[model samples]
Target: MRFAIISVTKEGQKLASDMELVLRNDPTVIKVDLFHKNVKDTVSNLFNDYDCWVAIMATGIMVRIICPIIKSKLKDPAVLVVAENKKHVISLLSGHMGGGNKFSIKIAGVIGAVPVITTATDLNGKMGIDALANQYWFDVKQPQLIKAVNQLIAENGKVDLHLPSRFRFLENHPLVTRSYCIHIWEKSFIRASLPGKEFENELDLYPKRIVAGLGSKKGVAGEQVFFAIRSALQHLHLPLERLDALATVDLKKDEEGIIDAASKSDLPLEIVTLNEISDFKHVDCTPSKLVQREFGVQGVSEPVSLIRAGESSRLILKKTAYNGVTVAIAVSTN
Candidate 1:
């Protein structure tokens, strides 16, 4: 995680410098930038750039400066306020989704200061939905409902949680029995209501487990490839955000259309070599005559999706041909 440490006073600057040294040594931290000059402007300009902001100043001063620039909890960087005397570190904003609470505790531990986290879920020793999403890398489809779901958990009200089978351990949580109803999530859950139930408190969390495999004609436009992938996902009633990555045969590694589509979606493209595909004899897809003759592989989209999805991966959507492109999707077991 990238961090920006800002301080105004000399004493605070010294403390910020010390904190930066400690944070920089931490493996999880990627970079740390210290700023003692133009405090307000620095904070405003770098607010969205870094993952977290450690302000070595009074909480009131930090609050006043950030008030205007504060955005959604999901988009805003975590803000931590530390006293100039180094007595307390407070989680000022974006406690859960932005990791302010966790970052504050880490900073306090290294600096020997008390960590002040006021989020009700943390205080009550219950896991918030936002925190769970962060932990497992799940995308919250309706971030607006996070507050309502967490409020139910905090107040000991019932919250029905639908999750993938791999995440069944969450059912054993201390608060799960009293405040949550756990159900195995299925694709059908996306389009229909559960039988004999009206779960008004249901919260859906989409795990980042889907990988898309692409096969496009030469000189095809990136827009067409992207549209095919999006349309395939929509047919399954899954949000485009749930797509984790893109995959294609190594033969197309330099394909501009595929590369452009991955870049536009901000997802990594996994290149699977034809040798690897041929050596693996577990593919369940039928061989395409043209693909076999040209590429010496049964298919591009199906095998590539399975290989990239890792062990025990299964196809959710088979090769579906679109205009100048073919799209396939698979669920990763991991």
Candidate 2:
């Protein structure tokens, strides 16, 4: 992840340089830039450019400069404040979703300082939804509700975890104390159940499980394609959040409907040409005579899904027809 280190003093500059050198050698540390002047104005402008910010200055200064530019915790970059003496590294904002807490600890270890994390969930030794999402590569739907769900854990209120039989071991997480219920997987629900004391308050987490292959008609509206995909997933008892990406033949890479649906859902779009998909044709597939005559391929959805899913994948849902669209689903092997 890219990090921006803003130093405001001579001592802070020296420490920032030292930390930059140490982080440069770490494979996980992608890019690190040090800024020494015009911090109040320049730092906020770099908010969207960097993944995290390490400010070698007073916490109050960081707070004042960051508060106005502060956005949703889900989208903001991790903010950490460091003392010039290298004695304390405090997570100032976006402690979980922004990876501030973990970044703080690692930076502290390198600088010989104490990592001070103020998030209640970390301090109390409970896992927040953001932390859980990061661990499993799950998307946190409705991030606004995360605080309400975490508040339940903080108040010692009941927070139950309902896992599918395959994931029942997750019930052992520290936050799941009073409630541990193994559930059947053949249901429409996500199976990632984090319910608060009041049933209305809940945290919605979804795994990046399925790849959706789409074939849409020319100039088709995204709403139609998106609706078809959601309906297919619903019919198969799969949560839409489990959709990791959208796959299609290269011809449809610029298809308005496919591109719009992927963009709206924040999913990566993977496309493959007929040549790349031809290699997978021998790998058990349903043939479409009409599609073969028109597109020079037996199938678009199924083969594209397999290609995007890599070698260790299975075709879970064969091509399903929808108005002006064809859809298929593939899952990676466990």
Candidate 3:
């Protein structure tokens, strides 16, 4: 996650510098920027760039500055306020969806300060739907319905919940199951029919378990690979956003088309070594004569997808050719 630390006073600057050192060492943190000059302009310019903002200033000042720029909770970045004296770290905005409350606790622990999280679900020892979505990396289809679902959970009312088989572990969470009526979904929620009246208050969460593997001819256009990937997903009735990552052989790691396609989708591309593919015992895909002759491997797309998807994974789409590109799809059970 990216973080921006803004401070105005000398003491606040000192605290911000100290926090920056600690956060920079954290493996989960990607980048941290410190801003002590042009505070208002910096905040306004970077409000959407960073994932979270740590302000070593007064709560009222931060609130007034952010009020005009604040958008929906889903799009806004997490805002945290730390007292200059280092007595408390408060979650000021986007407590659940933006991960402010969770980060507040983590920051407080690092600085030996108290974390002030005022979200109702946290106070009552219940997990909010938005928090759950953030924790498990599930995409919430209708974020507007999140409030109603959480409200029912907060009021001790039953909420119908639909989850994929891989996420069944959440059914046993003491806090999550307190008011949840769990049901397992076998297919993509997009392809599922509308729920009945009995499930009027249902909340469906889509886990990002799909991975696409690509193999393209030399000098293939990035648009061709990208379109082929989208067509493969559409053939399986899977939404484009459900894709978690892309995979390819190490031989094609320098392929410009593959790199550009992954960049356009904003997804990580996993490169599988030829040695790993050769030694892998699970090779159910059909052997490719051209791939075997050129790369010394039976296939590229199928094995790459299976390798990247981890254990208990199965192919949803076999190696299919699209012009000069080949594509395959895999769903990870883990």
Candidate 4:
């Protein structure tokens, strides 16, 4: 929602000024920070500090300077460039699919620059898979899935949308493509006479599911917790998508593993109060004394909320010495 713009010309600054005014007023635009001048060292130092970054300078250096920084981070913000003439606009990468595309178009309209949208599917009105994935919190790492969707649409005139389970619709996005289908598939697998099952292959495109929880000591290093948590999940054949969310106390704000894991999985943490957790019925858990005295009701708060959220945990992925740094796998009741 935040953008950083770079410019070296007075005209460019003026244009950025106009765009900033429009962007500030636009509800969609959260905050626009314009940087007209920067020392090479300063630019290098504060490069990765914003959510979304825009390089308006009409030079090859913008892309070069931004690319390495983007690649270095686990999650990269959208990047785009505006021509000095203000006539041509280019979305170099992470355009509409990742959000940079939408930002590019909006900026283009405000500045009167021609927004050059080059994504084939966006141009064709086929489902914008990346944007949809972003919206639905689906793990869209499979390029094959996106390509398959596009390929089906390209060759067959339309692609089918089939889901085994229907989460509530988030919004009616203009870019989302609707295909020929009588009805969508439901996860219940009960309806004998549903709409159609022709799109099973499409539904199988994504890895099924993932569920995870966070446990950490007050001072546990985030990197350490993440390493152990990820290692345990990998050991148990769990994809990051299976991660439901993190559960933890209110105190630890520096919980790197919880923050990083949720960001990676696009799942938010579900907090539990200490009072609620004090009522959880204890069962035979390993290292009984350690887990009981330190992890359950009396010790930490995240687990009870996680349990209350209908995350029926099937496995404690990793046995932890600390209550705050634990990662758990929830059962699939459905």
Candidate 5:
């Protein structure tokens, strides 16, 4: 996450320059611009080109001007307010859910101030590292096994790459041709990786970021389902390897044959509830009157998958046995 930190300070006080050294530890705070006592640039410029804004200032009035500026933008970056005294840090808005929240906490932690983390999920430490990894365009080698996430907190803890952190380290340089974490996966996104022994057959998960959804009627042909999935993805202009996991309604328990297929393919199954499926659907589609009333069309047809672009969905079943089915495959909706 790129940031433009504005420190409202007085002339000849050298607070802004002194503050720069304090914030430099956070790499996510890619850049910081100082606004001395006199600069008239509105805080809106922070949203003009950056992912978020960090305000390290003293007066509530200074913080007030920034609020309206952020209110005007449709795509708002995370906003954070802290005191120059390094005494307190408060996430007035967009703490975690917003793009700027995590950075705000880091800045607070570094300046020797308590991070006023208001996000309930974060305060409890139940925050999803996978989600964070995804947001930063980074990958997790062992997501489930990640004991704790090592975040680069900027305030007091120096943002040192070698610092003991739970998050795997990353450096900005040439695009990682070989597997690397934290990046937006474009359709033209190409990557290189040594074949995981598990995927020795095709090594399909070279750059995994997609999730697949399956929708099969009582008995649709597998060939039709596969072709339908393929054709649907091609129609959507998505790639095959981006698949991260397989999704379906809980109707298909662990006994569900499709579950076994995903296991064979090394894709984990993410069985969602009827409500969760509906929340992700792109449109209010009705698959069948009976099923629609019971579950959203996405649960019935599996169409809500949208992790990122350049990814797709597939149904794994016996190609020989035909089962009438429809599948929706795509990336997570971050």
Candidate 6:
């Protein structure tokens, strides 16, 4: 997550610089840019580039500049406004989904300022559905359900939470143990669980635990590669949303088909060198003689997946060929 800090006054600029240094300690923040002039144009250019915007300017000025470009809570970047003297930190836009409300408090803690969070969910001290989804890297399948779930929480109502048995931390978490929530499984549902009768407010979170390795001919079509990967995942009973990333041999670094497939899935493509693939001793999958002769490695997908994952990684699906593409799936040890 990148943060863009915009300031006009000397005090605000100094505060912005100090905040940038303070936020650099967080591993999640990759970059932070400071914009001292051309506030509107700079924000306009950087709106889509950064994850959040920290404007050390008046709230009215922020509103006039940001309102015209504001799309929605889901699509917009988190916007925060700080006073020149750093007395107040205000979440001006994208409170829940964009993480503005939560980040405002973080900035306030560093600057010894009051965080003004106006969101109803935060006001009621109820966990927002979008915040929960963001915490787990879970893509909201049905975004409309977020409103229903948040509304239920805000109304002092209970909603059932379903998670894998292994996630005992979340099951016993302070946030999850609140009176407005209950834990339930697919197989167990008591009559009193839905005391509010809010059947439409369930939130489902899926874990992205699968890493897919891809290999394909140079000129193969993207659709074919995608079809092959999707088919393999379907055969293995793995949801596409659970795919964490895509791995491929470095030789396919410029391959259009594999790139297209990964782009369509919105997964990061981890390219491995030939030496890494050939020397991978963790995985023992079948090797192809033709591939070995041409690519300097007996196999591409399995070794690449194993390299991306550590030595303890487990191969969930062996290399499966479809048309001119090959894909393999692995579960990371961690």
Candidate 1 lDDT, 106-152, residue by residue in tens: 89998899999998887887788887666444666677678887887
On residues 161-258, what C-alpha lDDT tens digit does candidate 4 reach at each position?
44443332312333443422323565622111212454333433242233454556656655666675566556443444445555665554356666
For candidate 4, the per-residue lDDT at 250 reads: 53
Expressed as tens digits, the lDDT of each residue in 66-173 for candidate 2 is: 899987887888999999999999999888888898889889999999999988877777777676665444567677777766776666654555454544446555
CA RMSD (A), model 2: 14.1
Clashes of 6: 0
Global local distance difference test of model 4: 0.53
My TM-score estimates for the predictions, one after another, are: 0.60, 0.59, 0.63, 0.50, 0.37, 0.60
**Any runs in candidate 4 off by more than 4 Å, and if so which?**
39-48, 72-74, 135-144, 154-157, 164-175, 178-183, 188-334
**Which stretches of candidate 1 lie above 4 Å from their native place?**
173-179, 187-201, 209-334
lDDT of 3 by residue, 1-334 (tens): 5789999999989988899999876534646899995778999988998879999998998998999999899889999999988999999998988889988987898889999999877888888888877654466767767887777677766566666664566677787777567778776541112235544544556674677888999988889999988888765545565678999999899999999999998889999999998986553366799999998888998888888888877566777788898998776745
lDDT of 4 at 131: 53
- Candidate 3 achieves a global lDDT of 0.80
Better structure of 1 and 4 per lDDT: 1
Error of 2 at 291 (Å): 38
Error in Å for residue 299 of model 1:
30
**How big is the positional error of residue 263 in model 6, measured in Å on the Cα after superposition?**
32
TM-score of candidate 4 relative to the true fold: 0.50
Displacement of the residue 163 alpha carbon in candidate 6, Å: 1.5
By descending TM-score, how would the candidates be arranged?
3, 6, 1, 2, 4, 5
Tens-place lDDT digits, model 5, residues 1-334: 3455666555223544665776554322334665544423656444555555566665475466665666522245666667767777677654533544556556666666777766444544433333234333333444322222223121111111121121122333222111133333333322222223332211111133555556665444445555555554453334343356666666754434565556554557666666665665442232456566655443444443342222332221111112455555443322
What's the lDDT of the predicted structure labeled candidate 5?
Answer: 0.45
- As a whole number from 0 to 100, the lDDT of residue 156 in candidate 2 is 62
Name the runs in model 3 displaced over 4 angstroms.
189-201, 209-334
In candidate 1, how many clashes are counted?
0
